[model samples]
Target chain A: MNIDMIRASAARAEGHVRRTPLLNSHFLDEIAGRRVWIKPECLQHTGSFKFRGAWSALSSLNPEARAKGVIAYSSGNHAQGVALASKMHGAPAVIIMPKDSPRLKIANTRAYGAEVVLYDRAGESREEIGAKLAEERGLTLIKPYDEPQVIAGQGTTGLEIAQQAAEAGIENADVIVCCGGGGLTSGIALALEAEAPSFRVRPAEPEGFDDAARSLAQGKIVGNARPLGSICDAIVTPQPGDLTYPIMQRLAGPGLVVSDDEALQAMAQAFNRLKLVAEPGGAVALAAALFRGDEIEGDDVIVTISGGNVDAEMFERALQTRG
Target chain B: MNIDMIRASAARAEGHVRRTPLLNSHFLDEIAGRRVWIKPECLQHTGSFKFRGAWSALSSLNPEARAKGVIAYSSGNHAQGVALASKMHGAPAVIIMPKDSPRLKIANTRAYGAEVVLYDRAGESREEIGAKLAEERGLTLIKPYDEPQVIAGQGTTGLEIAQQAAEAGIENADVIVCCGGGGLTSGIALALEAEAPSFRVRPAEPEGFDDAARSLAQGKIVGNARPLGSICDAIVTPQPGDLTYPIMQRLAGPGLVVSDDEALQAMAQAFNRLKLVAEPGGAVALAAALFRGDEIEGDDVIVTISGGNVDAEMFERALQTRG
Candidate 1:
């Protein structure tokens, strides 16, 4: 939660991760009655903010662990991020993904030069398989959200936003970030709380996966009432992680939920007007800002577009939904 | 053209025009046997490089001219650019478009606060009608191309690329730009010919509208032998303009052409791999790099994506073509 540690992590991971631009959202601004700014992590290498955490975590590994390579279990952005980051560090990576994971994500991870091992979500426990692989291979397991270095690495995005907003002459802007396991929201909240104390950090959750919001209200982690169902595949985790829940509780301003239709509409608007191909998960923050504008408080709002790994079919459908 | 004047125009239009990003093309680079960089002007304001030209042209107008408003004739990107730019400058704009122009473009221009005046391309002369309207309304006519200020504005893109390349440690990258009325190529050539003299500036022309290529070789402006036919609607100009042709004669390197299929494939690839929504014309340079790799000389080749204002139906069809 220290700003200095987060800054150091940012400096350490400089060339490894891209400083994705904070672009102005003209259409969103007009619709929401506020000046909208987008932090396009969708443009980040590996097509998500996960790379920041993966690189930070991997880079902090000891020589012995590094020599043994790394293993991760993720069906989406985190998989690609680990694959690419591990390759950059000259360590082999093996990603365990659900058999039903999108072919695009699988292809992208393979393209990044990683070995993809698919398992049935219904029949197998990915964590167990990942741990078994790590144990047998004498490799390190880089958890997507739980690790301290990973959280700190993700915090750098908030640090960059604070710096970028200041440079853009924005003194205090509300930040709406999509939440799933809460790694990104927690990291961003921690960073903002330390540096830009006046800035409000809100967690935008998909309708069924409102654990973070529930947890915040109860002052503890909360499990989903039912399995998640949404086109926003990336942020459908069952619950927030132990490491991220406390941080979200401490700094998260308010939690909001957006429907699948809202996410799709936001995705279409982003593609047409901003010319940015945001995945459904990436567009959730924007969806909340546009569809639930009354819940937000501020003239200047910054939303995090967390990834851009959507396939053609999905994009076409999203656009159709908008029409 | 004076390099200082171009530089000054670049400085004047700096904040008004976006400094579009130069994207890495991993798939094209592998296929082309070299590194490929894509300058994504498709992501520019109003979804085209025309924004640069329009903003530059409109901003340079005298107070009296500004008060009188402006008129432009274009079927695609130019119309949208002029509409948006004129609105930004507080000058009313009237756009003369073919009655059959894509409904999306017509709607976009209207949404940008421009008056849409449709004409039948087969019957009435658009220029004559546009000029008459300008004369009657006391509005200034803003030609889409064949104008110094418009060329200077487009030159700002080249200036940005040259500066960006230098910063990336690329001293002599090959730059491939799509050519229509030759305004973009001429302006880019003028900028690179002076700023990055060692770099080769190649013009990518659609197979049907090779007027710029033919004109360059014959040492004069040349008309297409047949009517232009290409999916790349934005660059289907039948002839090169007098102003742009001479500039192309003085500054352009060899011009290259690609088939309709090739352009479609490039557009699909841009959407799939780069997560960029590029219109057909915007993808022509990429198509050239993918299909005509042997003709290009350097290990580093930069392709300019001219615009991203395609009809949604057409985009869906193009994506389906890949299937």
Candidate 2:
């Protein structure tokens, strides 16, 4: 991938995406024997880093394309991101979400003025409905991943982290990103590889959904027969994306896995000590770093916290389980 | 009274106190019919703005005084603040907390390396025990409020807000702060009154604990005979401090009250929209602006979020009630 092209894409989406603070964690520093910094995409507009990619893809469109509108297929962060970004650009958005998706996410997406089309994931594929709707309505289909512009947009987070970490006198650190389709991890890894070569990019995923980790080990893309039974519902993809797989293969430093219990404990730690309401998926990288200790090195480590849109009831249940 | 003196105290405590962000709120702007910003002291080291005052007090001490240690009397934020501040300053801290205080607070204070000194608030005065201990152990008693250095320290938050608002191109805005003993409100008012004369400072207290508002109106400090039944446990003080009352009388713009339900609703709103885990006390000023919309008249408004040390169960319940 061309670094300058990625940087240009990042510049285009700069104002649209929040320059979220890279927060320092005193508690994580003590436990991990490393200086830990969190890139809080959880604080981003629409509560996720998916906004970066969504805005990048939508904004790259010409006037005619934008006028035709955009369509996305996801029940999670990407849906909200695309909806909000399209709304910001005055372009209509149609999000095909699973009917069983969390009410909070659905409400949030619709609140951003996106036309939500609920479909049963068990009965029908969201892709089929989303593609059909896009074709029928003359709308642009914005893929959640597997797009160059989207990858370039996600790269901006890494760019910001590298800049901020350098300013903080953190010369080299492990940048841990939670992986599903590998958009976030691949983008971040490519950016870090080009800008801060000293910084290692580690992809962290839940145990059951370890496709990225397994793929990295096998030097090829891998697929899982069953989805992850982890609380990190956002990164439960069974396979990595075609575009992101090769990038991850080249740029990823290491891949790590953490259990559901570890992720829950890490989420609670973030809530109590850091005062950050990170979702289970968002807490996975930090969870892996803290739980799978020897996998990471150096005194300084940066974890890309992907989102903060966990269901309130689910958060309560997680807290109760902690007790 | 001396602005330079306050600035010096702030500078002395800069490293110890968190330079909390003045966050922009899109949700608040849409709901309140104005651009809203939040100074999130809730994410401070001890989960409250009290940490700034306590840290300032401890840091300003002479070498001899530092060696002797510090003591404080409180069942909430103040206790935790003093404990954490003293620990940061490498001084022994003894917190005289009410015996009936929540187990969580006791655990927090102890976690910060303070010696927990429980006193029977029903039978004996906590102040008496604190004073006795201070005298016997040669430890300086750090009052929660009513201290010049502490007030000056709290004033730093206002200073930063003024600077941040200016940077954000907000020339004039109404700054609302939650009032307890008027420490935070008075300090913030004084800072804004001096540095940003165009800006106005308002005191927002929970409905039942409207002593600050009552006293402001009557031009004399008045105590609430009955305990407030608000969920904002941190700001349920019965009276304003002597030092804070006079400062507030001279500098405070206005006084307002918000209901417990409003505070809880605001907390839920902050969690969902801003991804902030603010406790009830922290959300009061925002709640005042949100619930009592008719009284406010400004294009820009800044609300001070005081703390985020809410119990997980309490937070869960609040979410369920207002989610």
Candidate 3:
């Protein structure tokens, strides 16, 4: 899709979602040896960027389809996003979530007035469960990343970055985004490619789950070999989506990965300097920005802190982590 | 002194300090039973609003004083603000800090290239030390809250709030401010009185350290009966400043106070829903907003999350606090 579609999606999502703040820090800048601007999605509705695409998808649905409701599968962020968006639209949503997802995430999702169906991650396929739920309930299945509307909705972040960067007098920036299934990364890449060609989007993932990095390097879609346990649960999708992969493949630069420890350190630094509560998974881009500064070739960099739905225990541990 | 001065300060301080975003939360709105717009000063430079007034004070100084340098005494935030601002303006800064201040705060102030002299809180008066140093060094004393330029600098935040609230279509609001010595509160009150008179400013303080609240009620400055061993270290000033007390006395509504436990709860809630790391003092306004919803008379409310410079252990404890 073109920038026009993304702009239209931003217009549609306007007034429904928060225009989250863009923050700058001289301390972070000193560490990166460049001007570091941060877009904290932790402040977004449901504490993540998922709500952007969720609002886009649900709002795009026809009145009949909206009344019938929608179905989604997520570990946490996406579930809450979809639930809150659906509720705001007076529609019902059923979310198929992994049984092992963090309790805080599950509670937040339920608190948003959605029916949550917990399933075994190893035994049940979320896509299949979502499809079944949609068929059984006469609801539309809203794929988290593969849909155009969702991608367009996520592109609104790119539009905001471009607009905010321009306001800050920045013409060139290396944008680092936390990647799960390439939805946020690809959408941002497309928007930047259209609006700010001088700016580049770089995706960062956890060490054992760098599917996006592998896929970008090999010129094809790639999948993680196994679901290695990690603290960064938010961006551990097995593979990128079909629609999101191509845009990311075309527009994104070399990808980056950080250890879980590095992510924890990033979270702590974010709390100390930026005063934003970022979950370990949400801090991947910050980890990359802090550790992989040699790879950045721009005078300015934008790091996306994509989520903050971390449990209290985990957040406390993150706060105690030292770089 | 007025909106014009506040506007000029906003303009003067525009490029020096960040125009921190004003955030709106439906979740917070639900809790308050009104439109809750949050102006989180926790995101400002030096992780607090002190930087604003510091910059205004140092920048407005005469060439002779600016060249000679400046001196100040503060627990933490104001020290960092003055040090950074003085460094930026090519002036030397001597900061007198309490011996037992947070190690993180001491390290941060020194990181900005200031001479840090720690004095025993129980033995020495910071003001006397600061005055003595200013004489020996021929340095200007930048009082934290008692000066006009500093107050004007703090007023920049008020101008931003008024401008941002207007953009959000909020005409009248009960603006809750975390009160220390009334610098920020009085500055905001002055600005709001001139630019957004329908909107009222209310000062919120931690229990046992509610000197501002007591002084406002008595129509005269009143110090705490005893040294309050409070968790809200940032706002534990002896009493309101002579310059700040009058403005707050005339403009602010009846003040509110929250217990230390309530402050911690507010910090936890801010972390979970607002993705902000607020110190105990910084959170008093939010604590009032969350627990004292009955006192708010307007349809819209704005609460300022003032600072986020808490120690890691304290933040960890706050996260574990369930309310």
Candidate 4:
């Protein structure tokens, strides 16, 4: 919510989190016609920046509350983040996932020592199931992005970006972020506003599932008509969060959109040039940075590969894009 | 070389070289049956630790010598490393590579601003061509390994490992390294012997191309009868270097070898669990750690993924090994 709170979260999360490096390649620069810097959160603890927020929220809980347990509903990166964070904290977590979720994700979440409860996506309401389960098990429900602590946790990434940019001799540039419900985008926008005001944050979304882009354009929350069809399944929220939209509206630049193919091509580029694996959703910001360069200004541009949890088949397809 | 020389190289290469992070995965630990820490130089600039040595050798040169540029003979990682480093230092580089080398490697080396000269592996001697070119162009020949400054540069990796292990609370462990002409392995051995005495360096090689292992067993340098057949071409050298053999004989532990299949499997595991791209040769140390656990001791082990320059087809083959 604020710089102080984000700094506090950073303090709480220090030593527990990996300070991932800021990666760059001249090959990527050629594509964008400018110097391109990548903050590869794909190399983070849970292969995503979500772990920062997860650890922040879980660690801030009272000793007794943490001992009781926590619960959340996510089928992908957030599920794995909360699972690993809770396990590391010596606490239990119950993740409510749709039964139709990828088996690899469900298996990965469980492998991290969390209890996964699957419900039918068409027939069951995750909220009702989550609320009942939380009540029955005395578990705290950790919202994926809406809560203040979670946003502050995600904001810690922005603090790192500010410092890393300074280290890279970058005074001003647009910081592109992959956006789902505006949690990461808004958090980074707030942190950079306080710490590196010359730097601007821009939300990047996959086309056809670009709720964040539409919302920012209209100066209000707008819902996507079809969110389930995008290959960037990791970031397909129906609408921007009420809490995060205002922060993004006030601090962020115009949102950028790239097609799923662009995301795949970006994934291939990350793999070939930077030697980093990036899931399609995680690669959307990089895709925008490379393919939507006209909309992004400055001699330098920084973007985040927010996650790298794609399945093998999807990754193979990405590699084929380059071929 | 001594620790002081390595220290000087580290200082010279400080801002230019990326201090790649030490990454870990609990899943890798479970498979290895012990704690496994990964020093992923695959994330280094140029996607390999060769850049460290390249930068060190180039920067250590006198202004006049460096201005005349440099030459090296390598068809893969080392060629790219020297090219990028020379380019960055405002110096030209001439790389002599085999005509049969992968087109991707040849193209990448040239793209880094180096002039590539192709010679037939079966018909022409690269060393003779290299010597003629260096003498004619006034170019300093930077050997891929077996050179004092180059070894000192590679030794910087060991210095980082010692510090990172100390931070991770590891007092004693086997530090596994992929071995070629023993530049990296011997350099790390000499370094750990001085800095972290409890840490033992072990050379890892693909089976049948185990010259380092056979040499260490016989207490002398031994050449591989056939070195051109292995998929792990990155770390396949005919014999350990004269300069590096003595250092390894004095400070390194027994060498370990893994099958090419195992190396591919390790590469897949790196992709799945650590979100890292590990070419066949780079994955050998990790393969030995995970699949040859009986040859190692103690509760902890460290391994390096030395480089990641595999072409798309090779990486796909690695992915298939897991399936």
Q: Report clashes for each candidate as comma-separated counts.
A: 0, 1, 0, 0
Which candidate achieves the best lDDT against the true structure? 4
Residue-level lDDT tens digits of model 3 in A238-319: 8988999899988996999999999999999899889999999999999898889988888988989999988788888887
Q: For candidate 2, write residues B1-323 as lDDT tens digits.
A: 55675688788875557777777656677888888888888778778899998988998899899889999888888998899889888999999888888898898789888999998867998778877889998999898888988888888888899898887889868899988988888888888877898887889988778899899999999988777567888888879998999989988856888887888888888887777888898889989877777877777888988998888877886787752
- DockQ-wise, the better of 1 and 3 is 3
Q: Which stretches of candidate 2 lie above 4 Å from their native place?
A: A13-16, A24-26, A30-34, A62-64, A99-104, A118-138, A167-172, A227-230, B13-16, B24-26, B122-125, B227-229
Candidate 1 achieves a global lDDT of: 0.84
Better candidate number, 2 or 4, judged by TM-score = 4
| Reference-based lDDT, each prediction | 0.84, 0.84, 0.88, 0.92
Between prediction 1 and prediction 3, the one with superior TM-score is 3
* Clash count (model 4, backbone only): 0
Q: After superposition, how far is residue B286 of candidate 3 from its true place, in Å?
A: 0.7
Every candidate's TM-score, chain A alone: 0.95, 0.96, 0.96, 0.98
Clashes of 3: 0
Which candidate number maximizes DockQ?
4
**DockQ of predictions, in order shown:** 0.57, 0.63, 0.79, 0.82
lDDT of 1 by residue, B146-172 (tens): 888899889888898898788777865
Regions of candidate 3 where Cα sits further than 4 Å from its true position: A99-103, A119-129, A136-138, B120-125
Give the per-residue lDDT digits (tens) of candidate 1, residues A1-323: 56676787898897557776677745667788888888888777777899899999888888788878899888788998899888888888999999998787788788887899999999999888888998899988888887888888889999989987887778767899988888899899889987788889999988887888888988877889877667887887888898888888888858988988899998888878877788998899998888888998877889999988887799898889863
Query: Considering TM-score, where higher is better, how would the candidates rank from best to worst?
Result: 4, 3, 1, 2
Off by over 4 Å in 1: A62-64, A99-104, A120-125, A167-172, B120-123
lDDT tens string, model 4, A244-313? 9999999996999999899999999988888899999999999998999999987789999999988888
